[model samples]
Target chain A: GESVGLHLPTLSVQEGDNSIINCAYSNSASDYFIWYKQESGKGPQFIIDIRSNMDKRQGQRVTVLLNKTVKHLSLQIAATQPGDSAVYFCAENEGSSNTGKLIFGQGTTLQVKP
Target chain B: GAGVSQSPSNKVTEKGKDVELRCDPISGHTALYWYRQSLGQGLEFLIYFQGNSAPDKSGLPSDRFSAERTGGSVSTLTIQRTQQEDSAVYLCASSSMAGGSYEQYFGPGTRLTVT
Candidate 1:
């Protein structure tokens, strides 16, 4: 089963501040993980992805960290902007060779206070 | 098409009525997927079609829900004897299976409301 949040963790950061969204996955077999952003009325847009073999991966202004020991995944935004306010989702792929049957976690809404 | 597209952005139907939602994948994608997002349930995997074969249908909630992709391109999901529980945003996604990294491109989705 995927990770289900008992409560939607709220992350409120001022514009230009750094924001970190965390997720705890239950499947240790999960190796490929991706972070997606969904606006109010749109499908999720891929932000970044990281393979289990690496602990950290960086994108333009976002980063993904994989901690298999605790089965935790986290996304870090370098400098949060108003445009970054949206719901962030973490999707985990069981393995590298699977057909990409992803198990998604309950999303966390990032509110950037401008 | 430039990206995945779904027909009937929004649909409201009466209970026990039937409804069909359509999805047109990217021109060359060989793998297509269907997902459902209900009020409390996060996005859930409903079905998957690779090429013309669906190696997995384990995610479908009930026998009433069915999906198929024709010619490995366009696909449709039909709900029989619609119930209020079936109301949700049905999302369609596609990806190139041959490539090493599989990234699913998703459509805006069809919001179905059963009254």
Candidate 2:
């Protein structure tokens, strides 16, 4: 059974500090991976995504690193702020499937202290 | 310019009853997806519809769970004889198939409580 899991259930960081959330995936054939941020009472918002062909991808203030060898993924936030507090999830798309279904990992709740 | 929208932000139904959840995808989006998120849990794939093709329901938990997309626009997920374990937030997402993009925009999920 393919599964995605987070290494930590909760991460508390002081405001303006860098934060890193880790995820491990069981399936090596997953070609596309994404990081989503879900705020209270709101839907998950796309943060950053990386394809298997790429080792790292960066966005505005975030970065997603994919290590295909270890089947691990990570999301890094620079200068974390109070507004960055939310649950973060990592999802993978199986390479063999074209249906666009995603396998998600248990989320990591990020709490930013002021 | 609008994103995906779901009806009835919250739903409470008794066990053994049926409930229908609706989803409106973004305009011109050819792909729509349904997912379930339990408390403190990640999203679970439920069903997917692309254009006019047959929906991929492999992720549906059981026979009691079913969904349909009309005119390739809006979608409906219905649960029959719901159980307390069925309580969760149902999420809907839409993505444009153009250029083989896989980015999906999600809607505020409907929190379902089966009492």
lDDT of 1 by residue, A9-104 (tens): 567899999999998888777778888887876777889988888999999999888889988888999889999998888888755547877777
User: Chain B TM-score for each model?
Assistant: 0.93, 0.98
**Cα lDDT, model 1, residue B39:** 59
lDDT of 2 by residue, B7-73 (tens): 8899999999999999999999999999999998899999999888888998899999999999889
Q: Each prediction's DockQ? A: 0.62, 0.78
Top candidate when judged by lDDT against the true structure = 2
Residue range with the least summed lDDT across 10 consecutive positions in model 2 chain A: A93-102
| Cα-based lDDT for every prediction | 0.84, 0.93
Residue B70's lDDT within candidate 1 is 82
Error of 1 at A95 (Å): 4.2
- Chain A TM-scores, per candidate, are 0.91, 0.98
DockQ for candidate 1, please give it: 0.62
Once fitted onto the true fold, the runs of candidate 1 whose alpha carbons sit more than 4 angstroms away are: A1-8, A95-97
